[model samples]
Target chain A: MFLALDVGGANIKASVFKADDAFALRSAKLHYPLWIRGVDGLPKAIEQAVALLGCDLKGASGVALTMTAELSDVFRDKKEGVDKVLRKAEEALGSFKVVTNDGSLLDPDEAVDRYMDVAAANWWCVGWLASLFERDCLVVDVGSTTTTITPVVEGKVAAKGLNDVEKMALGEIVYVGALRTPISSVASIVPVNGLWCRTSSEYFANVGDVNLVLGLLREEEYDVATPDGRGKSVEECHERLSRVVCGDRNMLRPLQTRLVARFVYEKVVEKVCEGVLQVLSRLASEGRYPEVGFAAGLGDFIALDAVERAGLRGVLLRDLLGRDNSIALTSASLALYLAYKTGVDVGRWISSLR
Target chain B: MFLALDVGGANIKASVFKADDAFALRSAKLHYPLWIRGVDGLPKAIEQAVALLGCDLKGASGVALTMTAELSDVFRDKKEGVDKVLRKAEEALGSFKVVTNDGSLLDPDEAVDRYMDVAAANWWCVGWLASLFERDCLVVDVGSTTTTITPVVEGKVAAKGLNDVEKMALGEIVYVGALRTPISSVASIVPVNGLWCRTSSEYFANVGDVNLVLGLLREEEYDVATPDGRGKSVEECHERLSRVVCGDRNMLRPLQTRLVARFVYEKVVEKVCEGVLQVLSRLASEGRYPEVGFAAGLGDFIALDAVERAGLRGVLLRDLLGRDNSIALTSASLALYLAYKTGVDVGRWISSLR
Candidate 1:
C-alpha cells in the first residue's frame, strides 16, 4: 500500500491504501491544526502526527508527503529554499526516504532548479485532481485560512511560485476557511438593522463558529477546529458553542448574536461560492473545465454549499477518496495517487525536476 | 506636505495637520472603518469611499485613507468584527473624560479605570501614551498579522503597514487583521532542500511581511483578484515558479504552486536586511523603557517596531488602528501634544504581559 499524506497549512490528514486496480482503505483520518505551535509545541505536535501514522500505516511500501509547508515563508531564491525543505523533511522523517522536488529520490545534489518544483496550496489535497481528468481543469480547493483556485490545463497547477505567506492576499488563495477562520476578517461590519455599527472581530468569531451557531456545521458529523487549539473533537465543540446570542448558555436563544453570526457565516460561504463561480466563469472563457470532481475533508456543508451555490458537478471527494474509507485522501492525495499509478515516481518526479 | 492617511479596520483617518500641534496641526481626525460596506473592491475602495462620503475629500483633507485592507479575506473573520467597535469605543471614551493615558492633562476621565480598563484590544491607542511622555516615545503596536514596532516614543514617523495584506491579519476593528493567528497563516512559504517543508514550529520567521513588504499601502492601491481561469498574472506566477522549480509552467504544479506563489513576495523580503530586522534590535531593547506611544493610523510601523524591539518599554498604539498599535487616543494630534508636555500617563507600572 502506498501511503499518501495531504499535509496542509491547517490540516494533516493521512490515508492508507493499496491502489493497483481497486483501492482498499484503512484508518480513520485525524485532522490537527497548525495554530499554536508557539516555538515550543512543534515537537509534541510532530509526535502526535507520528503516533497517528503508527495507528494506520502498516506494511506500506512507500510514503509521499504532500504539504503546505512550502507555503510558509519565502526564500531568496525559491529553488534554494526547496533544498532547505528537503533537509528539514529528512530530519523530521528520520528513516523515511522522503521525496523532494528533485529527480533524485533522496540525495541533495546542488540542483537548485531540480529541487523547487513541488506544488502545494492551502488545500494541498487538490494536487490529486491532476489525476482525475487528463484534460484541462480548474481546481478550487477551499480550506481554512485560504482558498486556492488553480488553473490546470491537462493536469498541472497554474499560478505564480508563491508560498502560503505570499498567496494570502491574492484572490485564488482567499484567506478564509470553513472551520477555523476568524469572523472579523470576513466582514468588517456586517449590516445590522442598517445602522452600520462596529463589530468585535475576535478569534471567537469564525465561519465555523457562526456556521455552528446557525446549524450549518453539525456537531455529530463535521470536523471542527479544536476550541483548545488542537485536533478537533466533537464533544468539545458542542460544549464551546452552546451559548445563545442572548448570552444564555447551553439552552439556545433566538437573538442578534446568534442570528448575526449565522447570517455572517452563510454570507462568507456565499462570498466564497461567488468567488469560485467567478473563477469557473473565467475558466469557461478559456476552455479549462474538466468533468468536475468534488472532494474535501470537510463535511457536507462547505462542499455542498459551494457546489450548490456554484452549481458545478463532479465526483464527490468522499467517494473517490481513493479505494478506502481510509482517511479519505483529499484531491492532493488523488493527484499523488495518479502520479504514482502513471509509473511516475512522485519523489523522483519532484526531486528530478530541473 | 505629504498627507499620511491611516485607514484602519476601526478608524477612518484624514490628517490635515502634519504633526505640528492640535489645532495648529489643522488635522481633523474622525472615526471610520466603523463597518465594512462591501469587499468587491466596492464601497470601501478609494473611489467608492470618496463617493460614499458625498464630498470631495481631496485637496481639503490631503484625501488619504490608511487601511488594514490587506488584512481582509473571504474565509477568515476580521480580527475585530466591524461591529460593536464604535459603540464600545464611545462607551470606553465616554467613561474617561480623562485627558491622558499620557501624564499630561489629567481630565476627570484620566482615572486608572479610564486609562487601564481597555474595552477591547482595538483601542489600545486611546490610552494615550503620547500625551503621557515628556519626550519622543516609541510605539510598538504588535498585534496579529503585523507588528508596528514604531519608535513613536520619539517625534519622527518611522514605519508602515503594507505587506502580506498586513492590515487584514493584524486586527478586526478594521475587521481586517488576525484574530488567532496560526504560524502557517502568517505569510507564504517556499520549500527548501528540494522538498515541501513547513517552517519550524520554533522560531522560524518574523512579522516584516505582514506590514513591511510593499512599503506603506494607501487607499489608492487596489489590485483586482486575478481572474480565475483567465488570470494571466496567477499563471505568470505559476510559470515563473515552475521554471524555477523544474515544473511545467503550462500545468498546475499541484501542492506546491499556491504555497510557492504565496511565499514569493515574503521570501523576496526575507533576503533584505530589513526583512529580518525591521530596525536594529539591541538598540531598542537596552534603552530607557519609554511609555510607548503610537501614531493614530494603520501605517504606524516605524514607531511600533522601535518599541517592540526595545524590550524594556511599555507598548502603546492609537485608537485609530483596529488592534496592535495598542496606544489608543481620543484624538491623534491632540493626544500626542498633551503627552509631549507632561508625561503624566507615563507610569512606572510594569507587568509581565510580555
Candidate 2:
C-alpha cells in the first residue's frame, strides 16, 4: 500500500491505497489555507489531514509526496517556500519520495537543492495519470484557486514550462479558478443599469458567489468562506456579488445582480478559453498534437467547457477515475503510479474503477 | 472635552479634543477589519481604539459618533448592521450622540430607527469641515479602501446621495482608495512586454505595491497587508506587481514589472478622475459650482491628482489642518463640530491648527 499527499497553498489532500492494489481505499481533501496558517503550521496541518484520511501512517509501504504549497506567499520566494514545506512534511511523515515537474521522484534533501523543479509541480501527477490513459492528450486540472493545463506527447509529459513563471508565460497555468477569484479581477467594468460601471477594487465578492448566483455551483460546493463572511444562500450570494460594483441588494434588483453574475461567469470562461487556445497553439508549432482533453478537480466542468470551445473532444477525469479519486487527483495519481512501479496490476485496477 | 469616534468597516478611529477648543488633543486610527472580527467584536475593537487615543471613555464630557461600519457585512442588512454597530458602540463608550448623513444628531435608539440616514455617513463630517473654510467647495476624502467626494454649497452640505448605493451611482464614492485595492480591478489588461496581457483574477497584487514602486507613497503609508502576505520592500513589490499578469520576477525583468506598475497606477488615477468628473458634472447641472477642491485622508495625494486633472485648484487638507488631524479627518471633524456646537471658539481653533 502507498500513501500520497498533495499539499497546496489553500488545501491539503491525502490518498491511501489498499494493500497490494491500485484502488484508492480512502481519500480526503481539506481546506487549511496555509497562507493564513503560515509555514510553521504546515506540519500540524499535514497531521490533521492524515487524521482526516483515517489511515495509519505506519501501515503504508511507502509515502509519495507532490506539492504546490510553495507557491503560497508565506515564504519570501518559491525556493525558500519549497525548502520549508519539505522540512515540515518530513517532520510530519518521515522519509518520503517527492515528485518533480519532469515526473522524477527525489529524496527530501535533493528536492531542497532542486527546489525550482519540485515547486508548484503538483500538476505533473495528473499528466502522468493522463499519459497512462492515452499517448497524446492534454489534461486540465482546475482547483479552487488555479488551473494547470498539461500536455503529453508520445507517452511522455510534453509541457514547455517546468516552473510557475514559465508556465504562466506559456499559458500552461491560468490563475482564475472555481472559487476565491475576486470578481473585480475578472472584469474591470461590468454592465450596470445599461451603463458599464467600474468595479470596486475591494475583495467584496469572488467567483464562488458568481457561480452560486448563476446556479453553476451548489451551495455545498462553495465550501470556502464567502467574501462577506456570510451564509451561502442565493440571496446572500446576490448581495455579495452586487458589491463587486460597490452596490448592495438594496441598490440593485435581483435580476440586475444576476445579470452581473452572468457577465462575470462569461468573462471567467473566456479567460480559461484564452489559456486553452494559447497552450494548444504553442503545442501545434512544435508539431505535437493532442487527441483528447481530460478535465479534473472541482472545476472539471469549466475545463470541459474550455476544451469544447477549443473544438476538442473532452472527457471528465472523474468518469475514468472514481469521483473521490478525481477530486483529489494529484495524490491519487501519485499513489497509483507508486503502485504500478511496485508491480501492482494498475491497469486492471483502473479498469475496475471505470 | 469631547471624544469622537468614526467607526468604519476596516478601521476604527478615535479623536479627543480639549474643552472649549477645536484643537485635537489626541487622535488615532487602528485597522480592525470588521469582516474578520464580526459584529460581536465591534465593542472590543472600539474599546481598543479608545485606548489607542489615550483617553478614558468615562472622562469625556460627551461622545460623538459617525460611522460607516454599518456597510460592513457582519450584519444581515444595513438596518441590522446600523443597529448592531450602534449597540456595540453604546456598549463600549456608554451613551453617545450619533450623526446622520443630513447632519442631525440623535440618541442610539433614534439612530437605529433611522438607520438608513445614519448608515455610511462618515463623509458628512468632512463636508462640514470643508464648508467652514469655503462656502462653495468640493471636498474629496480618500481613505485606505474608498474615496468620498462631498460638495458643500453656500455654507451647507449639498450631497445628492444619502447612502452608499446612491453615492456609488452618483460618483460621490469611488471605491478605489490609497491602499488595499486589488491591482487587477484597476485594469483588466496591462501592458506586458509590448503585448496586452490579461491580469490574473487572483489577489496577487494591490494598488499599495503600485504606489510603492512608483514612489507615489511612502513605505510607512502602506500599513495594510500585501496580497501575497510578503514584505513591503521594493523588490518584493516588484515581484507582486509582476504576478498581476500571472508572471513572476523570474519571467519579467525589473523594467517590465515597473512598466506594469506604472500602467496600473495610471488606471487608478483615471478611475478616480472619472468619478471626479461625474460628480462635478452633476453639480454643474444643478448650477452648484464649487470654487475650490479640498483633499484629505491617507490618499490625499491621490485626491490632489484627481482635483488637478479636473482643472481645479487643489489643496491638501493636511496643509490646512495638521498632518495627523487630516489623516484622521472624519473623527477630528466630528469632534471639532461637536465643540463648535457646544460654544467653543471654532474660528480661532481653526486658525490655531493652521
Candidate 3:
C-alpha cells in the first residue's frame, strides 16, 4: 500500500490505496489555517491526519505527495514554501516522491529544484487520473477558494499552463469557488429589496453561507468557520447573507435574503461557465472539444451546474469513485499513480508487513 | 487661528483657514500607514502635519477634526477606533469639535456616543463644503482605497446613506479607488499578446502602478510603496503591471504591459462612472438632477474624466481653492465651517497671538 498526501492552503488530505484492488484502504482530511498560523502548525496537522487514517509510515511501501500550500501567505515566496514542505514531509515520512505538473514523480532532492512544477500540482494529478478513464474530456474541480479547469485529450493531460499564474492567464484557473470566497468578489451589485444594491465589500459573508442557505451544502461539508463567527444554522446563514447588503435579519425578510443568495449563486455559476467556455474555445480552435466534464471537489454541484449551463456532458466523480473516495480523489489519484509507477503489489506488501 | 485635521486610513492632513478669506493660510499632508501600524502612530503623524503647516496649537483659537481613520483595521471596531482617534486628537490639541455625517460638529464626549456618525465622515465635510458653492451637485472624492460619491441638493447634503455599509448598499460608495486598489479587483480579463488573459489575483500591482504608467499619477503622487515592494520608477511600474498578466518585463513587451495598464485605468473610470450614474439616477427619480460635479482628492482627474464621460459639467476644486489648498480641502473645509460657526475672525486671532 502507498500513502499519498495533498497539502492545500486551507486543508490537508491523506489517502492510502491498496494496489491489489485499486481501491482506497483509508483516507482522512483536516482543516488548518495554514496561511495565518504558518507552516509551524503543519507537522501537527499531518500527525492528526495520519492518526485519523490509522496509517503507519513504516508499513507503507512509499509516499507520494502533491501540494498547493505554497500559495499560502505563510512563506515569503513559493520557493521557500516548497522547501519547508519538502523538509517537513521528509522528516515525517522519511522519504517521498512528489508529483509534478509534468505528470512525473521526483525525489525530494530533485523536487526542490523543480519546485514550480510541484507547487499547486494536485489538480494535475486529478486531471491525469481522469484522462486514463476518458480521453477528450474536461476536468472541473471546484474547491473552497478556487476552481481548476483542465482538459485531457487522447488519454493524456493536454493543459498548456503549468503554474497558477500561467493557468490564470490561460483561463485554466478561476479564483472563484463554492466556499470561502467572499460574496462581494462574485458581484459588487446585487438585487435587494426590489432594487440594485452594491454589496458591502467587508468579509460579512462568503459563498459557503450562500450555498448553505440554498441547501446546496451539507452539514458535513460546512466544515470551515463562518465569516461572522456565528453558528452554522440556516437562520445564521440568512443573517450573514443579509449583512452583505448591510441589512440585518429584521431589516430584510428571509425571502429577500434568499433572493440575494440566488443571485450570488447564479453569478458564481456564470463565472465557472465562463471559465469552461474559455478553455473549451481554446481547445475547439485546435479542433479538439471535450466530450464530457468530470466534476469533483466539495463544490461539485457548482461544476455540475456549470457543465450543464456550458452545454457539455457531465459526469460526477462521486458516481464513479463512490462518495468517500471522491472526497479524497486528488490524493488517491497520486497514490494510484505512485503504485503503478513503483509496481507495488499491495497483497504481497501487506503479507510482508504481517 | 483654527487648525483643521483630517485623519484618514493612509494619510494625515492639516490646514489653517481664516474666516474672512475662506482660504487656507497654510496646509500640509503626510503619508502614514495607519491601518497596518494602528493608532499608536497617530501622535507622531499628527505632530509631523502640525510642524509642516508651521502651526502652534497653543496659539490657535480652537481645533476642528474630521476622520476616516476609524474605519482602519487598527481598532477592533468603529467605536474603539473612534475613541482612540478622539483620545489622540484631544491629547495633541487639547479639545476639538468633530465633523459628522449629519453636517454638525460634536464635542469629543458626544462624538464617542455617536461614533457611527464620526467614523469616516470626511466625505460629508467635503459634500457640506461643496453645497456652499452649488446647491445641486455631486461630490466625488476618490482616495487611495475607496471612493465616496455624495450628492447635495437645495444647499443641503442630501445623502440617503449614513455609514460605509449603508453607503455601499446605496451605491454612494465604490470600493474601487485611484490608488492602492488591486488591479485584479477591476477586471478579471485583460488583453495580453493580442489575446484575452485573466489577470492574476495576486497583489502583483495596484492601480497606482497603472496610473503611473498611464501618466495620470506623477512621481510625487506615487507616495505609497508598490504591492511587490519594488521601486516607484517608471520601469519598475511597467514590470509590476506586466506581472498582473502573469508576465514579466522579459516575457511581455513594454507595449503589452502598457496595454494592460490602459485597460485597468479604463476599468477604474468605468467603475467611478457607474457610481456617478447610480447616484444621479436616484436623484433624478426624485426630480433632482445634479447639473455639475465637484471633483476633489488626489484622484480629482479621474472624477473629472468620469463626470465629463457621464455628460455632466465638471468643476475642479483646484480651480476654486488653488493648488496647495485643494490637496487638503477636507481639513480646510472643517476649519472654514468652524470659523463661521464660532464667528472667529482668524485674521485678527493670529494678530492677537502675535
Candidate 4:
C-alpha cells in the first residue's frame, strides 16, 4: 500500500492507495491542522500522523508527502516554524522513509524548498488542467486576505511578475475577504444607491463577518473556521457579521449580504482577471491565446471569470487529475494528483511546514 | 507674541499671545477642512465665527495655518496622486477623518458611520509628545523620514520622541511615521552579536513613499499626508527613499515593503516597549513630571517613546514649533507654535491628538 499526504499550516490532507493499484488510489484526501506552538509542532504531528496511519507501523510500504504548509506566512518565524515541525516528524515517524522535492527521502534540511510559494499549487493545478484538457485558461485562488491569478501556456505558467498586485483597475489586493480580513480595511464608505456614504472604519471590520450577516455562507459546506469541524449556524454567523455595519442584523437584507460578499469577491476577481488578461493580451498581441492551464481550490470561480473576462476556455482539472473515485476542490489538492503523476515530490517540503 | 495652529480634517486651531504673555486669549477652534479648499483660509476661518470671536482675527492679523488638510486623501487616491496644486482644495479628503477620542470637526454626512478602537490620531504631533515628555519642552519638528528631537522644559517640550519610530517604545500612538514611511520597510537582523537574535518586521520602505509608490498620491501638503508644505517633491522623495534600502531597491524587498512599514513603527515599537519595560524606568520617569505639552509636525516621533516609555516629567510646548530659526539645522525647519493652546475649541482637540 502507498499513501500520499498534503499538509498545510492550517490542515493536513492525505490520500491512500494499494501498490498493485496505485493508479486506483482513493480520490479523496484527509485533512488535519497542525498546532504551531512557541515554535514546536513536529512532535504533536507525529502523534497525529500515527493516528492518521490507522493501521500498524509495518502495514504501509511507502508514503509520499506533498505540502503547502511551509509556504504559509502565518508563522512569525518561518525557519523556526519549519524546524519545529520537522523535529517532531523525525522524533516520531523515525522509521518511515520521508519524502520531499528533489525526489529524495532525506532529512528536512536536505529537502528542496519546493513548497516555498504557499500559493504555488493554485497556479500549478491550473497548469495541469490546461495541459490535460488542451485549452487556454486562467486561475484565481481566492483565499482569506488575498487573491492570486495565474495564466498558463503549453502546460506552463506564462505570466511574468506572477504576483500581480498592480493595476488597481484590476483591483489590487482589496484587503477584504470572507475570513481573516478585518472589515476596517475595506472602504471607509460603501456605495449606497449610487452615492458614496461614509461608514465608520471601526463600525465594519472583517468581510467574513459581513458575509455571514448576508446569509451567503452556507452553514453545512462553508464552515471553514467554526470549531468541532462543524460550520457556524447560519443565523449565528449572520448576527455577528451584521454588526460590521450596524448593531441590527436587519441592517442587511439577504441580498445586501451577498452583494457585500460579491463586492469583495469582485474586487479580487477584477484584479486576478486583469492580471491574467494582461499576460494573455501581451502574448496574444504576438499571435493567439496560447493553451493555458488552470488550477486552484477555487477553480470554478477562476474558470467562470476566465470565460467572461478573458474569453478563454478553462479545462476542468477533474477531467485530467481525476480518477473515477476522486472528489477534490482545490488546486493544492489537485497538485497531489499532479505530483503523483509526474513524481515531482510535491510534499518534498512537508517537514518544513511548521 | 506668537501664535500656534494645528489643523485637521475635522478641526482647525489658532492661538495668539505675545512672547511675554501667558496665552491671554487662546481662541482657535475646530472647523471643516473643505471650507479652506474653496475660500481664502484666513478670511473664511474668521467668517465662520465672526459672531463668536474671542481674540480678534483681523486685529492679530498675521496668521499661520498648521493644517492636517481635511479631504486630501481623495486627491491622493493612490492614483493621479497629485495635481496642479488644487486650483481649489480638492473635494472631501479621504473617506474619513483620522481622529482622537472626543474630537471631530466634520458633519454627520462626512463622518464614519461606525465606531472603532483602531488607535488612531487626528494628528501625529502634540499627543505623541505628551505621551513622553514631562518637563515643559520645545519640540523641533524636522519630519519626513528624518525627524529631530529637542527637549523643552519650563515652557518647552520636556522630553522628545525624536524618531517617533523609536518613541513608540515610549507610550504613544503607533509610529507608522509621516511622508509615506518609505516602502522597503526592512528591519535589521539585530541581536546577532548578543546571545539572542531579534528580527524586525520592518522591510526597507520609507515613510514618504508608502502613499505614493503606485502613483496613488496627491500633492496636497496641508493634510494628514505631511506636517509641512512640500508636495511636488514626491519623485525626488521616492528616489531618495528608494536609494536607502541598501539592496536592489528596484526589486520588491523579500518582506512586504508596504505592510511591513506598519509593523516597523506601529507594531514593533509597541511590542518592544511592552517587552522592555513594564514600569516607567527610563530617564524621564523620576519626579512626577508636570506640564505635558508638545510641538506639532515631527513632534509625533518624540512623543512616541517619551510619554509612555520613560514616563514624562511633564509636558511642554514651544512658542515656536520647529528649529527653523535656530542654530540646530536647515531644511529641518519645524512648524513651530501650534495655535491649539488655551483650552478653547482648538485646544480641546489638540489635547486629543492621539
Candidate 5:
C-alpha cells in the first residue's frame, strides 16, 4: 500500500491504497487548521490522520506527498514552512516523495530546496487525475479553503501558471472557498429589508455559515469551527450569518438572515464563475477550448455551479470516485498515479470502480 | 486614582488617572489579540497592561471598564463574551464600573445582566469626551480593530446607532482598521504594473504592512503581529505586501510591491471615507450637520484623511492630547471623563495641556 498525503493550510487528507489487480482505497480527512495549530502541530496531526485512516505505517511501500500548508502564515516563508512540514512527515511516517508543480516527485531534500514548486502543487495531482479520463478538460476543485481551476490538453496538464501568484493572475486559482472564507471578504454590503448595509469586516461570520443557513451544507458536514465558536446547527448559523451585517438573532428577523445567506451564496458563486470565465477566455486565446469540465472536492456542487454558469458541460468527479473519495481527490489521485507509474494496471482498476 | 480599561477584540488599553486637586493621567496599551489568546488569557493580559502602566491596582478607588472585546468570536455569544470578560477584569483588578452605551456607568452584576448595553460601549465614552470639547462635531476614532464615527450634537452624544449592527447600518462604524485588517477585505483586485490582478484572500498580508510600506506607520508603531509571522522592517513589509497577490520578494520587484502597497492604502482610505461620508449625509439630513471633525486613536491619520475628503475641518485629537495619549484615546478619554465626573476641575487641566 502507498500512503498519499495532501496537507493544506486548513485540512490534512490521507489516502491508503493499493493499485494491483485487486484495488483497494481508504481515505480520511482531518481539519487541522495550520494557521491555528501552526507548524508545530503538523506531526501529531499527520499521525492522527494516519491512525484515522487505519493504515499501518510500516506496511506502506512509499509515501506520496503534496502540500498547500506551506502557504500558511505560521512560518516566516514558504521555504521554512515546506522544510518543517517535510521534517514532521518524516518524523511520523518516514521518507516521502513530494509532488511538485512540474508533475514530478522529488526526494524530501530536493523538494525543500525547490520549495516554491512543491508548496501548493496539489492542483497538479488532481489535474493529472482528470487527464486520465479526458484528454482536454478543465478541473475545478473547490475544497474547504481554496479553489483550483486547472486545464489539461492533449492528455497532459497545460496550465498557464505554475506558481500561486501567476495562477491567481490567470484565474487558475480563486482564493475564496466553501468553508473558511470570511463573509466580509465576499460581500462588502448586503441587502436587508431593501436597504443595502455595509458588512463588519471583523471575522464575525464566514461562508460555512452561509452554506449551512442556505441548506447547501449539512450540519455534520460543517467540518471547520464556526466563526462565533457556536454550534453548527441551522439556527446557530442564522445568528452567525446575521452578524455579517453586525446583527444577531434578536436584532435580525429570520428572513433577513436568509436573505443575507442567499446573497452571500450568489456572490461566492459569482466569484468562482468570474474565475471560470477568465480561464475560459485565456484558453480561447490559446486556441484550445475545453468542452468537458470536471468538478471535484468537498465543494463539487459549487464547482458544478460555476462550470454550468461558464457554459461548459459539467461533470461531477464524485460520480466516478465516490463522494468521500472525491473530497480526498488530491491524495487519492497522487497515490493512483504513483501506482500507475509503478506498472500497476490502474486503468482496469479505475474502470471497474467507475 | 481610577484605572480605566478599554478592552477591545484585538487590543487591551489601560489608563491610570487622578480626579483630585491636580489632574494626572498615564495611559498604556497592549495588543492582546483576544481572538487568538481567547478569554482564558484576558486576566493575565489585563494584569500585564496594568503593570506596564506602573500603576498600583490595589490603590485605585475603582476600575472604569468599557469594552468591544465581547464582539470577539472566542465566546458563543455576546452575553457570554461580556460576562467572561467582566469576570476576567474583576479577577485581574477589582470591583469595576462598566460603561454602557447610554453614557452611564453600572456595577459589574448589573452590567452582566444588561450585557448588550455594556458589550461595546467604549465608543460612547470616546464620544462623551469629544462632546466635552465641541458641542457640535463628528468624532472619528479609528483604532487598530474598528472605526467609530460618533456625532456630538448640542453638547451630547447623538449617535444614530447604539449596537454594532445598528451603528454599521447608520455608518457609525467602519470595520476596517489600521493594523489588523486583512488586505483582501479592503481590495479584491489590486493594480500591479498597471494591470488589475485578483488578490489572494489568504491572511498573508494586512493593512499594517501597507501602512509600513507607505511610510504612514513606523516599525515600532506597527504594534500588531504581522500576517506572515515576520519582522516589522520596511523590507519585510514589502515582502508581506507582495503576498497580497500571492507573490513574494523573489517574484515581485520592489517597485511592484510599493505600487501594491499604495493601492491597498488608497483602498483603505477610501473605505474609511465612505463610512465618514455616510455618517455626514445622515447628519445633514437630520438638519444638524457637524462643521468640525475630531480625528483620534491609533489610525488618526486615516481618520484625518477621510475627514478632509468629506470636506470637514479636521482636528487631530493627538495634537490636543499628546500622541501616546490619543492612541489609547478610548481608555484615556474614559479615565478623563470619570475624573471630570468626580469633580477634578479637569477643564483647567485640559486647557493647560493644550
Candidate 6:
C-alpha cells in the first residue's frame, strides 16, 4: 500500500492504492487556497486530506508525490516554491518520491537538484499511466486553470516538450480549463441578442459560471468562488455571464444569458479540439497517431466532448478506474508509476495492510 | 480658436483647431495614468495639456470634448465616470459641447442625460472625421490599449455596432494595441530558441516592450511604465520580453529575445489584420467595400502595415493632419466635427486668435 499526493494551487488530492496494480483503495480532495494561506498550511491540509482517506502513512511502503503548487503565487519564484514544497513534503512524508516532468521518479535529495524536473509535473505521471493502457494514445487532463494534452506511443510517454513552458509552445498545454479560467480569456466576442458582443475584459465572469449556467457542472462540483462573489445558483450564474458582456441580469434575459454560456462553452471546446488536432498532426508528421484518448480531471466531460468533436475515440478515466477512484486518478497514477519504476513491493505492503 | 479634449484611460490629448475647413492649429498630448491617479488628477492634467498647447481656453469660441476616460477604473461605473468628466470639463473650459456616440454635440446637461452616448465616444469623432475624406473607408485607430476599426459608407459613419462593446462585437474593435497590451494577451505560444514555447501568463512584459525592442517605437514613445517596472532601453526591453517565456536576460541571448519580440509584434499585426478583414467582409457582403484605410493613433504604423498586408489602400493620419498635429488627431477631429456639425464660425474665431 502506498499513499500518493497531488498538490495544486487551489486544492490538494490524496489517494491510497495497491500500488502494484494501480488500484485505488480510497481518495480525498480538499480545497485549500495555498496562495492565500501560504506554504505553512500545506502540511496541515495534507494531514487532513490523508485522515479523510483513512490512510495509515506509517504502515505504507512509501509515498509518491506530484505538484503544481510550485507554480502558485505563494512563492516569490518557481525555484523557491519548489524548494518550499519539497521541504513540506519531507516533513509530512519522510523519504518520499517525486514524479518529474521527464516521466521519472526522484527521491527528495535528487528532486532538489533537478527541481525544474519536478515542478508542476503531475501531468507527466498521468501521461505515463495512460501509455500503460495503450501504446498509441493521448492523455487529456483538463484541470481548473489549464489543460494538458500528452501523446503516448509504443507504450511510452512521447512528448516533444518537457516542461509547462515547452508544452505550451508545442500546443500540448492550453491555458484554459473547466472552473477557474476567466471567460474573457476564452472568447473575446460572444453572441448576444443575435449579434457577437465583445466580452468585457474585466474578469466579471469565468468558465465555472459558464458551465454552471449551461448545466454542465453540478452545484457541488462548482468548487471555486464566483468572480463576483455571488452564489452558485443558476440565476447568479446568468448574472455573471451577462456581466461578461457588461450587462446585468436585469438588462439581459435568461435566454440571452444561456446563449452567452453556450457560446463560451463552444469556444472552450473549440480551443481544446484545436489543441488536440495540433498534437495529433505533430504525431502524424512523425508517422504516428494516437489510436485512443484518455480523459481525466474535473473537466473530463469537456475532454470527452472535444474528442468526439475531433472525431477521435476517447475513454473516460472514471470508466477505466471506477467512479470512486477517478477523483484521485492523478495521485493514484503517480503512486502506481513510482512503485513500478522503483521496484517497490507494493503487493506485499497491501497484504500487510489487510 | 476652438479647443478640443480627448481624454482616455491612459492619456489626455488636447488640440486647437480652426472652425473652418477643420484645419488644425496646435495640439498636445500628456501621458496621465488616470487609472492610477484617479479622476482627481483630471483637472490639473487637462490644464497642463492645454497650457502646453499655448492656447487660451478662455478666449476660445467653444470647446469640444470626447472621452474614453469614463471606461477607466477610476470611477465606480461608466455613468459616474462620464458625469465626473463632464463636471471637470465644465469647470476647466466653461461651457463646452460634448461629442456623443451619435456624432452630434450636446451641452453638459444634455450630455449627462445621455451619458451612454457620451461615454467612450471618442471613436465616433474619429469615424466622422474619416467619413469626410472618403465615403467608403475604414478608420483604423490603434490606441494604447484598444483598437477601433470603424467603417464609413457614402460619407457617413456606417457602423453596424454602436459603442465600444457593440463595435467589439462587430469586429470593429479589437482589445489589442501597440502599447500597454499584455504580451500574453497577444499569443499563448511564441517562438523561442527556434522552437515554440508557451509564454508565461504573468504580466512580465507588454506590446510596448515588443515595439521598443523592434525599434518600431521611439524610446520617448514608450510612454507607459513597463510590466516589470523596468526602464525602456533596448537591453531592458530584451529582459522584459525574455520574461514572457519565464526567462531573463541571463537565460536568453539578445537574439532570442528579439525573436520573442518579433513574434509578439507579428501576432498583434495579425490580430489587427483579422479585425480589418472581418469588417471588410461585412462591408463587402453589403455590396460596399472600403476603398481606403485611414490609419491614426500612436500605432498608425502598425495599422498601415496591417492595411497593406490586408491588400487595402492605406493613408497615414500624419499625412492628413501634419506631423505635429497628428499627436492629437482625435482631439482635433472632435473639434472639427463639433464646428462642422454646430455651424460654429471658426474663421471668426481664428481672426480673434490672431
Clashing pairs in 2: none
lDDT of 2 at B146: 91
In Å, residue B182's CA in model 6 sits off its true spot by 0.5
**Best model per TM-score:** 5
What lDDT tens digits, residue by residue, belong to model 6 across residues A1-354? Answer: 778899888888888766445544566778787977888878888888788888688988878898888888778888888888988978877778888887777887888889888988887777777766777898888877788888888977877787778888776888888988998898888656435579888979889888888787888887877788879999888888878888887777776676567657766876776677667656654556566887777788888877654446888877766544555677877776766666865444434332
Candidate 3 residue-wise lDDT at B124: 76
- TM-score of model 5 vs. true structure: 0.52
Off by more than 4 A, model 5: B1-354
DockQ, cand. 3 = 0.01
Query: Docking quality tier of candidate 1?
Result: incorrect
Taking the candidates in order, what DockQ does each have? 0.01, 0.01, 0.01, 0.01, 0.01, 0.02
Error of 5 at A314 (Å): 0.5
Estimate, for each residue in B152-246, the C-alpha lDDT of model 5 and write its tens digit: 88988888798999988777899988989998998898655324679998999888888888788899999989887989999998888777778
All models, RMSD in angstroms: 20.7, 22.6, 19.4, 19.7, 21.7, 17.3
lDDT of 3: 0.79
Q: What is the interface RMSD of each candidate, in Å?
A: 18.6, 12.5, 10.4, 22.5, 12.0, 11.3
Q: Model 3, B306: alpha-carbon shift in Å?
A: 34
Q: Report the candidate with higher TM-score, 1 versus 2.
A: 2
Top candidate (lDDT): 5
In Å, residue B20's CA in model 4 sits off its true spot by: 94
Worst 10 residues of 5 chain A by lDDT: A280-289
Q: Summarize candidate 5's per-residue lDDT along A1-354 as a digit string, tens digits.
A: 888999888889999887545688777899998887877778899999889888788887778899988877888888898999999888877888999998888999999999988988988878888887888999999888788899888988988788888888877899888898998898898756435679999988888888888788898888998888989998888888777777778877655676577667766866776677667655653556688889988888899978875657899988888887788988988888777766777677766755
- CA deviation > 4 Å runs, candidate 6: A1-354, B19-23, B342-354
At residue A270, candidate 1 shows an lDDT of: 50
- Model 2 residue B272 lDDT score: 73
Higher-ranked by TM-score: 3 or 4: 3
Taken over the whole model, the C-alpha lDDT of each candidate is 0.38, 0.81, 0.79, 0.37, 0.82, 0.77
Clashing pairs for predicted structure model 6, backbone only = A169-B198, B135-B155
